[model samples]
Target: MIAEMAHLDVVVPPEIVDNETSGETTVEEGNSVTLTCKARGYPMPVVSWRREDNLKIVLRDQGNKKVTVTEGDQLRLTRVKRSDMGPYLCIAKNGIPPSVSKRIMLRVNFAPVLEVPVHMIGSPLGKEVTVRCKVESSPRAVATWRKEPGEQMIISSHKYNVTEYKEGFYVTQMSLTIRNFTLEDAITYRCVASNSLGATASSVQVYEIQPQKTRTSTKNDGDDSRLGNQIPLAASDHDKNDLDDFYNELDDPINNYLDPYHPGGILDNDRDREPLLKDPDIPKSPTGSKTFPYLNGGGGEGAVGIGSRWWWWAWVVVVVFWSVVLPGRVAF
Candidate 1:
């Protein structure tokens, strides 16, 4: 007898239900929003919610706990902000060979906000200057430059240039450049931003400032002569007289003071000069010993002292007399 085959159920892959699930949603800031995702599959598929960018999802209901993936068919957000605007993913899986996911975009609308980087700008005359402001809003804002007091609208022209740069989906950089800045351009300018939600404005003031000055240094002839005339501390009166004599000798060409063969030249004068040992300028000590003036620091005199040579001559004569007379006596 053959047993009957057990009943078997067919396995099925997960499929997202588009009609029963939420699609693209738009809400204002500080408001609450809900996204629902439903799916059908065998073995009951599990539904999960996550950000398309893989960023943590904020849960306001559970004390603002942030989580990467939340298990449910519904994703609820309270007091939504502009940062919460992006694509979200709803995934469905049941341990099947194929899983399914749906993309839902969230857009949060907000009023136009303006931020001025510099409130006051100073520029030199006849030069160009640029002033910039930052704008943040949803549904791109119409930005403009307006001069205060008169409320005159400024447009791109030869005298002024208006520019805009989109830094992000909700951030724009607005700039106004003034060519050949002059006194007329020195005034309070306002940056105005308006959108479908609201409008905002900020101000910038331009003023004329003096250009930086460069300094130069110069030397005077009198100052140079004064510095040259100042004498050194170690120079003595004798040194000054010698320097003067040298200059005088140079002026008198007839003297030929530097000539080696001349009668009155440096060589002849040095040869005829009295020796320091025999000179009477050196003073005698209390013991009758000749003392050197420069060595003792007692006098700033003509030259360094040389003691007497009488003792040297006496020794030479004594040796000669002893050798001659004693040798003669021994021979006799």
Candidate 2:
């Protein structure tokens, strides 16, 4: 009897934490859930909860107040999302060398939803345009492109090109490219994103490009320096009279020397050389108004001098003509 009792004295190691992952606990979005976790051991282990993937656990209280619980049991989520489909950890510890934990996966199913950034899109003629439709669903959605009032599916063709591109984890983009868009391509196009759950659509208004008005730039007459292509306008009667007067005055060489101060008389210095009783301005020059250099001593610069400042006027005209004609002539 003593030998048989010795076998009953064998000590049993502590039991690791055990979590229940039973029958399908699939829950739809916008539903409540209460997952329970319990563990039995020699030391009466303590139970806790966490995300197995190290993500944050979102929970709600009685009043539907959102609370982020990092360390706790019974992860009660008021409204669940498809992201809550991942695994969660239920931990138990009782002075055990290695703590025990269990993983419970929550599955949530949702329908497809689609949205386009803009309702209206425009493209010019002879240009290619792309329309993007964003889709979101638990199961990957199959996007179909077509025009309004026609539920038929679109296939890859010469003019139209349909392609699917995933933008983010849950967001996918459906693009329809139309090459050389014209008035026929400018219509209300529809995109339908469908999954096992349901289907959704987004309408895009493609507007026909209107003819741009040809702008005729107005020429500003005041801008003279940059007006290389400026056309001359018809002169008025007053302009004609002024032009005729200018030509008539230029015809008389004597009028070129008219001075404001000495209107009808020779210059004072000129009068000193040869005094005249009559005015020089009155169409008829006084007798002996002409001063011939040969009559006087004509050799040097002073030899060719006139009675008044007429010599300087002639010198200025010669200098102007030489400077304009021989601009490249180097002077030593």
Candidate 3:
């Protein structure tokens, strides 16, 4: 072993082979897909896979258990789902100064799905209201608004405003606005979505709410009697005291001065007596007329008048004279 020293060991960073790896792939839902990543280095590079968004990878072969990283040069997905549609990253490293990564995009196609946020919407008459529906699909579905019962397509105009908003790569919000909503517009409307995969529809009901009616009450002659009867039900203590004072004043002898024929003297007969003052306990009618209590009845009907009591006493005296005094004279 005479002369020269030979070098055998070498180190190299990992580099992904572009021709052997997958960049972007599109497949239908429920189909199988495979992603391959090949890398080379002085020492054999270890290959691993992960999601570009750092989300977990679902392993269908391993009882659908989720994992952050999978060790393999080839990623196999059987029976792909829509949730598997996203960007994936393949990493290669073997104790190298810089690791290598390859981005692979996965797309899964599915049928159109329709969702109605509010199935029933109410708007006041001559007001504006909007009906909304959400759609999710790959390949960008075509959305349309159609009035039910006839399936007439809605066009963008002053009466009906149709609009679409993009919420995500595959999610869109569809809306139909009705200006000056009326009774005729209160019907079921359909939101239809169609794509190359499939077509779907959802319904929304629009209803017109009548404007609230305002009621006002006024004092009228026709309602005077009913209203007068209700006053006693709500009478307060102060009103009762005022009524008592009024009745006492009516009973005073000084009020007899108002009678021209019986001034300062007692009434000779009940027929000649009359009420000289209005009763204060009774309520006045809406027509500015006062109500009075009954004069001849008592014990719940009304208070008895002074003239009615006098009449009863005079009748008793006459009966006694006819039965006792005249009968005794004739017998003697």
Candidate 4:
């Protein structure tokens, strides 16, 4: 039994550590943290530390800490940020058996971020109005105005000529003057405020001008009048008589002249009646036919009716004269 134990001891490793140190770390910006690895082994194991991302290893020691490996074993980080939280590795090896320690994570906490102030400017209508926006955070914020659309914002330049003032945590102001307020001048004015964490935008304020009214005229029977006035009219004697004649003439032989080519035969005729010059509901005839056939055929025979009728009378006069003169001459 003794000989078997001696052979097994020769095969066993010297740096076999059974215990490890447990360290708790909480870090922040401009702060430091230390993680210690106290291990037990037969040959006094050597502790080595490294970062997972291949960063240069650093070590630091405090009071009651001796035989310090301040260059490779103990980790000391200064001015840590929230991003420094990760796994740190520590290994124990005595040139015999290698032992590893569980990873340690250092978390860095910080306060809430303070954002920039928001700037809002009202439009330049002669009408008076208020412009306002708000900012809230521990650290005070600086705000600016810009006109960029769907792009990185820039400060409002001097050319725009805006008046600016600060009110507590918020910044705002109205335009010095609106040169011209017109319908075409309406536009989306943007207000933006930013901080270290992020930026936000306010709803656009729009400017609109009420349309102006102008004088318009409406027609009445004898003269024009505004629609507001309801003039109870009394018809004149001549007007009543003219209207009565107009309606009576509508169905009379004067105006119901049916179109000749319009499939309807002639139904009425009156010499005293000629078609009214302006008929409102009448559809004009494309074929230039006249209402009276006698009028269209050129006064019967092209300007010869009167000459023919008078020609017979002229012959009678001439015969009577000649007969009288010839008989007297023979008697003499």
Tens-digit lDDT track of model 1 for 145-179: 99988889999999999999998568899999999
What TM-score does model 4 achieve against the real structure?
Answer: 0.28
lDDT (tens digit, per residue) of candidate 3 on 28-103: 9899899999999978899999998788888887788899899999999888887888899999998976999999
lDDT of 4 by residue, 251-284 (tens): 4443344333233323333322224323433223
TM-score of each: 0.65, 0.52, 0.60, 0.28
Order candidates by TM-score, high to low: 1, 3, 2, 4
- The reply for model 1, stretches above 4 Å from the true place, is 219-332
lDDT ranking from best candidate downward: 1, 3, 2, 4
**Candidate 2, pairs of clashing residues:** none
Q: How many residue pairs clash in each candidate?
A: 0, 0, 0, 4
User: How high a TM-score does candidate 2 get?
Assistant: 0.52
Candidates' RMSD to native: 12.2, 17.0, 14.0, 22.0
Per-residue CA lDDT of candidate 2, range 1-332, in tens?
Answer: 35543344332323433444332366778887877676677566677777666776766455544334444445677788877766777777777547777777776768888889888989898898888888887667888888876766777799889988886445788888989999888888899888888988889988867769986555663454368665665678669989999977774434323331245423445553233324342222235354333222222233133333566668778998788756756542
Best by lDDT: 1
Off by over 4 Å in 2: 1-19, 22-25, 36-47, 51-56, 70-73, 81-87, 91-104, 166-170, 211-216, 221-332
In model 4, residue pairs whose N, Cα or C atoms come closer than 3 Å (at least 3 residues apart or on different chains), thus clashing, are 30-79, 115-195, 116-194, 116-195
